[model samples]
Target chain A: MGTKAFWLATTAAVLIVFAASRLVTNDYVFFAGYVVLQYVVLATAWNILGGYAGYINFGTSGFVGIGAYSTVVLHKLVGPPIPVLILVGGIVSGAIGLGMGYLTLRLRGVYFGIATLAMAIVVQTLVTNWDFVGGSRGVYIIRPAHVPFIGGYIQYLFLVMLVLAAVAVAAARTIERSVFGFGLAAIRDDEQAAEVSGVPTLRLKLIAISVSCGLMGMAGAPLPYYVTYLDPASAFNLGYTANTIAMPLIGGTASWVGPVIGAIGLATIQQVSTVTISSALNLLIVGVLLLICVVVAPNGIVGLVRGKRRRAGRGG
Target chain B: MADDLLSVDKLGKRFGGFVALDGIDLTVRAGERLGLIGPNGSGKSTLVNCLSGTLRNDSGTVRFDGNLLNGLAAHRRTRLGLARSFQLPKPFRSLTVVENLRVPLYYSVNARPGAPHLAEAAVGERCRELLRLVGLEAKADRQPQDLTQIEMRKLELARALAAEPKLLIADEAMAGLSNSEVDNILALLMRLGDRGIAVILIEHIMRAVISFSQRLVVLVAGRKIADGDPHAVVRDPEVVRAYLGE
Candidate 1:
């Protein structure tokens, strides 16, 4: 599909989903749905760098922390609208992403992953020490009871996250088809070969990281309002990093749809299990599913499906 | 020297105590088919690496098409029209054979100064043309793993050519191929050279090298020992000794 049509379709689909979601009278549904939608954004964001560029970034929480903290800082200072907060959050985290890539892209392989993990730790430590945005003590956000059109603040956050998810998916799909995306894919395959083939590997990597982190930050921007209690521990949670990485791997990293599918499927399962089976089983569930994906379908669900289709075609 | 397409003066590279390339001097004319032959650990690959900006040379200058490529990145050098195929085929394993060629076309060729932005159709056309040139049109959609060794070599060459390079350094492109496949790659290289693209074919296969190169430069122990007519370079005593271990 053309880029324009794809975006239009995506926007339409998101509106439909949002409109349908509003019909549910239960506020808890919005609360759970918001988390699932947030993953859709985070996983898609992570895939841009990790899956597409083959640079595993263990700094999802770091970027998210930056975004959430940016909102908190802005909320304390100017008290900007949530949209402005999201934009500012994206910019701050994207710049950090670019800076991180500059410092560590040369490391290659697991070293780059280590550098990102270290960056997350560093960011978390900074957040913990900074008292302005509530350091180790944590801070409370008093969100307005109801938004004008959305009725409830949680519903507004849900609507914002849904839109962000669509945007993230659309952006991913656009990059996947562009020349820039092709260059990124080349770097993922073979860095030296990509370089000699005229791919600006370092530059592409920086752009990938920046975009990935920017979107991640956008996902995190709403968290301060969602939880109403923001702390370094929760904002910089390792759970965000793990889920961001796992979603793409479980769904398939080769295409943009993989992360969306992985995020929706995995997040929904986690959400459902957290309610039905105890919240303690969340990590255990993620672990067992990830293990299954790694063993039974190393390439993830998309790869597994593709393999089956190929085999069936051959057989027929 | 100014008229030469590529000129290297006193290029040196040392990996700690071991000297990989020591003050190597070489020049190639535009569209020149220059075969670079060297024994194992003789620094032919090292020289290629320096020229292509894969590794930084510790000393000396490399002037390619009037630009002094001292600290330029590999992609920058490629954008300046220098390209190379890997000794082992490094086709983007995830990409199909044709898509592998698209990478260079997108980044290198289209990125050139004053180059028109190629339409999507044009890019696809260019990829197909390259596939046809390398005789991989039949396997354009096939993954790199599915290709035979020779097909992989062809894909590698096609990928390099997609950059529309002024100079293509083919590093052992014909290695491990059958004799007919060697000739096949040799013919392909010769065809590229005829299209006004200078080629530096680094190969262990003497027959293919001799038949393909108008000039042969031999490297022994990180130094040039013989450089001149292909036949004479093969017969050079030092080159013979370097190969046969006299």
Candidate 2:
């Protein structure tokens, strides 16, 4: 599709969803929808570096926590609007991503993954110790009585998340089609080959990590107001890491649609199962789904569909 | 010497205490076809790596097209017109054959100043032209995984050429190919020479090297044993004893 057409379609789809969602009187749906949309942003962000560049970042919580705490710190200090906090959170997390990439990006494969994991633990510990943002004691955020136009604060949060998800998806699609995306794909295939082929691998990787972390942070920026309580444990929850990584892997990693499909599908399932079954089953489901995806459909759903289509074409 | 496209002086590289390359010096003029032959583990690949900025030299200097490449990263060295194919074909498996060519063309060739900025359609046209040059136009849409061994090598060469290098290093590009396939690669290299792009053909196949090289250099045990006309270099007592000796 042409760029203009793609944007228009995306905008229309988001607006349609927003308008439809308003008809629901149950605030529970909005709360659940907000969580799903948040995963959409997180999964899409993770895939930019992990899927495209083949640099698996295991520190999703680190970036997300940075964003969440950036909001807390900003809200406590300046009492800025949520939009402003989101932007600040993104910049702060992106800067950290850039710094981490510069320091440890030289390590490849498992080593790089280990470094990122270590960084997450370090960030969590630092935040847990600092009392200014409540540290381990946790901080409470007071939501406004009513959101302008949106009515309820939860509904407003859901609307904002919906917009963020659309923006993330659009950004990913643009990168996928651009020359930069090709560079990242080359890096994914072979770093040495990419370098010799005149790709500035280091530069491309730094950009990928920065953008990925930035998006993750933006997704977490509104969490303070949504949850009303912010603590290191909740901010750096392993659930964010697990869900974000699993969603992309289960849906597909190579395309923009994959993470969205994975997030919405898995999040919906989790929400439904949580009410009917057990919350503990969520991790088990994600783990089993990840294993199945890896073994049966290594390229995820999109790849599986393409593979089957190719097979059918050949058979015919 | 001033016009030499690549000049290496006192190059030295060591892994631990074992020296892979020891105080080597070589030069290739613009459009000069030079053959670098050596026994197995004689540091031929090491020299290529050092020159291409893949590996840093312990002690020495490499100047490419008047630019010092000592600390330059491999990609920057490529941007400065130094390009090399790997000993093994390293095509991007996720990309089609044509897309493989586009990576280098988009990043290295079109990225250079004064090179025409190709539109998206022009990029496709240029990719097709590259595939045709390497005679892989019919397999443009094929993934590297689907290609034959020889076809992968051709794609590797095509990828290196996509950078529009002033100096192209083909590191064992014809290895494991059938006799006819070797000739095909040789002919391709000769065509590249005709275009005034200097090539370093590193091979153990003497017949191909002798036919393709204007000058031949032999390395044995991390030291240059012979450097002169191809026929004379092959006949040199030290080169014959160190390399040809079974």
| DockQ score of each predicted structure, in the order shown | 0.94, 0.90
Q: Tens digit of lDDT per residue, candidate 2, span B1-246? A: 898899999899999999999889899999999999998999999999999888999998999999999999999889889999999998899998899999998899877878788888988888888888889989998889999999999999999998989999999999999999999999999999999999999998989999999999998878887888999988888888899884
lDDT of 1 by residue, B50-148 (tens): 999999999999999999999999999999999999998898999988899889888988899998988889999999898888898899888899998
lDDT by residue (A162-184, candidate 2, tens digit) is 99999999989989989999999
Each model's TM-score?
A: 0.97, 0.98
Candidate 2, lDDT over the whole model:
0.93
Off by over 4 Å in 2: none
Best by TM-score: 2
Residue-by-residue lDDT tens digits, candidate 1, A38-127: 999999999998888999999999999999999999999998889999999999999999999999999888999999999999999998
C-alpha DockQ for predicted model 1: 0.94
Number of the top-ranking candidate, with DockQ as the measure? 1
Residue A138 CA error for candidate 2 (Å)?
0.6
| Ten contiguous residues minimizing lDDT sum, candidate 1 chain A | A1-10
